[model samples]
Target: MSHSAIRRVPASVQSLRSRAVWLLLALVLAVAADAPSAASQAQAPATADDLKQVQQMIDKGHTDEALKRLDELAVTQPVVPGVHRLQGQAYYAANRFSDADSAFAAALVQDPHDLESTQMRGLTLFRMGKPAEAIPLLTAAHNWGPQTRVDPSYVLALCYLDTRRYDDARHSFALQYGFPPDSASSYLLAARMLFRRDFVPVAKDFAEKALALDPQLPLVHQLLGEIALAGNHLDEAIAEFEKERARNPLDGAVYDRLGDAYSRAGNYQPALESLQRAVLLEPYNSAPYILLGKVLLRQQVPANAAMYLEHAVGMDPGNYMAHSLLGQAYRSLGRTSDASRETQTAEKLQADTEPKLQNVK
Candidate 1:
């Protein structure tokens, strides 16, 4: 389920890209003096040695020293094609995000096609909380080919997530993870992302594709279970969840989900047992507690329901469902004032979350 780790290309491909850097460096040097300014024309161009020294400093974790050298170079070689790019690299290494952004901007101004500068600038903008600006730049850099180090595709996926472009985020993540076209993992990942955006039908198709490829794939059954639960297909959801539980008995989330499915099917005793197991497995999670309270209430055990509901609300005060269930318990116990208060809080939380849920969908 965790897709954050980016897969690296083969070492030979990386070696080839490394060799191409020299050619890129040469091209940058050839255009160093192309700036149409008297100051740039008066100054000597930065030598390959100068660029190499800064790179070596950065490589050695001497970003401060690299920045100092870059500052000196900027004074005399203000418009040098690759100097700002190197400066940006050093600044980024030092975690000076805004400074890095400015340096990369200068590098892009010098050479619009500078891939390294564009990628660095996009990453810098992302770090500075400007994902909208970062996306296009990252997309452009990713299109330049053979992304070895600092994968632009991974960063672009993150940018898409930040901007709430779920489909783009899923596609970018699949690409960055190096999933093959018909890979089971790719389909599963797509299903998960689509499910988050509430694209149920498409998500179900991808999930089914993953199952067709490998029936025993971890989390695939769980995903299908969740989709069925969302659609109120209680029997199908319970079956899928049971399949997932057989594969991963230790996963508290599966137990919690199974409990929900059983509860929706009006199988309270099994639901209670499953929910209690979920709570035992993940004591810190409020979800099982909330479900346990609701099931207890359904069985007309308000006293026990109130205890679980109180624990759930204590753990996650902002949970509207938990608050609402606690209110029902309070009403059953004839605590009118407490029930009124809980109902008001639940109403407010529901109103607040509805817009966010709508936006996500």
Candidate 2:
């Protein structure tokens, strides 16, 4: 974190407005109220109490005032210990990553062995999209063995993935979750982890490795089918899903996926058969009933579609898609008022859930 390396990170406050932020603020207060560490004790006794008060202000969502007090304290005691680290924590809480980096760097200069500073600096660099710079510090922090509940291993894995170091990511993830580094489950875990980040080709390769290691592995074929379906390779998806059905005959989700592929390929007859089987296999699941209703609507059987959709809506009142599709069915059946009511309900639900859906953090 040299002067030249301290660039402002483009972070959005809205993206990080979850309960995690609240917990972190609370953590600041909790840690500051604890007995002072060696760093805090190196300063005058008054300075230590003052720093604790600053942390209280930050915990109460007063970064601006907390920072002002820290500046005053630094002016009074030019060589005060742990001041820079407290400043970094305040900046981080305020979403000021560039300032946080500089403060954390200064703390490290005074005490290079500060594990908390190392971890915070690594996280700040990561938020600035400097994963290459963050890796060494995070690796060091990882070796410190859970100093706090917040694990740096997950961020390290993301760094490895972002840099396309698939092998490193696999090892890191295995270490994080206590899996054997070369085990089949580790490869599968890595594959799904990559898939979640939209690295589909690498995910497919790892999934292939998982399958090779254990031919009887469950969900491997289903994962393959999902990748194929995402790419609109309907024939491949259907084939892979059929193989998964063979491996997991009692899995209703496989039948539902199979029905979705058939419907996408305009094979409504096969779609109806698969969906019916899914419904029978999962009698209480609203998902199969919804898919069945969709297939029926596509087949121009509005009465049957409405019946299944009504049952699905009854089971999951908050499902916007079911409400929307039920609205369409009602419209087809000339039930104008019922269609209008369902449409309004669906729109309201969609609007209410949009913020949650867009919350990447």
By TM-score, the best candidate is 2
Candidate 2: lDDT of 78? 60
Off by over 4 Å in 2: 1-69, 76-82, 143-150, 250-252, 269-289, 307-320, 344-361
Give the local distance difference test score of model 1: 0.88
lDDT of 2 by residue, 198-309 (tens): 9999999999999999998888898899999999999999999999999999998899999999999999999989888998898888988898889899889999999999
Model 1 lDDT at residue 310 = 98
Q: TM-score for model 2? A: 0.73
Backbone clashes in model 2, listed as residue pairs = none
Q: How accurate locally is residue 210 in candidate 1, as Cα lDDT from 0 to 100?
A: 88
Give the residue spans of candidate 1 off by over 4 A: 1-109, 113-140, 143-171, 178-181, 354-361
TM per candidate comes to 0.60, 0.73
**Clashes per candidate (backbone, < 3 Å):** 0, 0
